[model samples]
Target: MQIKSVFIVEDDPSLQSLYEKILSYYGYTILGVARNGEEAVKMFVDFQLKPDIIIMDHRLPVKDGIEASKEILIYEKKAKILFASADKTIKDAALSIGITRFIEKPFDISVLIENIKELIDVKI
Candidate 1:
């Protein structure tokens, strides 16, 4: 299945814009961008057009990434959540909740793009 839609959950405004722009440049339709985990979940649930991919950040206001992912997963088990974080401590926590894909901080944009593309191409 080709991934066409994407949502970004990040606290930083710059990062949010960057992701939106870069992903759009790659031809992915941007569903929306959320600043916090709470907002992310709300957007997911409320929006009629469900996203094909969600780029989630670890640390967030109101709710952390793991908590938000759990909530969303409950609603959409097959949701492909791409966890992004600088903190190494979150790997286990993220994986425990079935979020297997991760992009480390300070990563190259090319690497991030490659990972997202790979995810969209995967059948599972």
Candidate 2:
């Protein structure tokens, strides 16, 4: 199977860097990073080749992750989006829209990595 690319939509710079590093180490391409929901939505919409997966954060400026996820899925129904967030309340709402999965904030890096791998299998 081809290597998968991942788009990160987190507002925290440190977390973004960490995810980028770990994903790169694991052989997944880092498609791009968006600092907020609005940017994430725009990046997904504008990209010629959509990333294989999206790592999204719930709290954000301009737009929340839930809305952004909704918008992206509207365009690409099968896109795998991992909604990683500290806000657990959005879990049900996010899952309702067909996000691949949710990984809670302050999560073990191993857990996140495992989820990404699982999504990759699904994609394949």
Candidate 3:
């Protein structure tokens, strides 16, 4: 099986490093990283082969996850984005925009890994 790829949109450096370490250990390729939502959208647009999943944080500078996900969906209607944020309020909104999943902040890293694996295993 081809290794799954992930694009991370997180502003916190520590969390970014943690995620890269854990996900890489699990055999997922880190496609790239984005510090904010606008960069996330731009990177998605520029990638020749889009990542299999996007780990998005809602409260981002420039655009926010919901907005960035919307913009991304316009370009790739079937984009699989997993909203990972502290904000619970945006869950419905993110789902409405076609995000594949939503996981609240401070979740277990194992859960996050499982979610990513589930997204990759399931046919879109």
Instruction: Name the best candidate (by lDDT).
Output: 3
Give the residue spans of candidate 3 off by over 4 A. none
Encode model 2's per-residue lDDT on 13-104: one tens digit a residue.
99999999999999999999999899998999999999989999999889998999999999999899999888888788889988889988
TM-score result, candidate 3: 0.96
TM-score of 2: 0.95
Please list the C-alpha lDDT of all candidates, in the order they appear: 0.89, 0.90, 0.91
Q: Clashing residue pairs in candidate 2, if any?
A: none
Q: Which tens-of-lDDT digit does each residue in 19-96 have in candidate 1?
A: 988888888889999999999999999989788789999999999999999999988888889999999788888988
The local lDDT score (0 to 100) that residue 83 gets in candidate 2 is 92
Candidate order, lDDT descending: 3, 2, 1
Model 3, 41-120: lDDT tens digits are: 99999999999999998888988889999999999988889899888987888898899999999999889988998988
Specify the poorest-scoring 10-residue window by lDDT in model 3: 115-124
How do all models score by TM-score? 0.94, 0.95, 0.96
Provide the global lDDT of candidate 3 against the true structure: 0.91
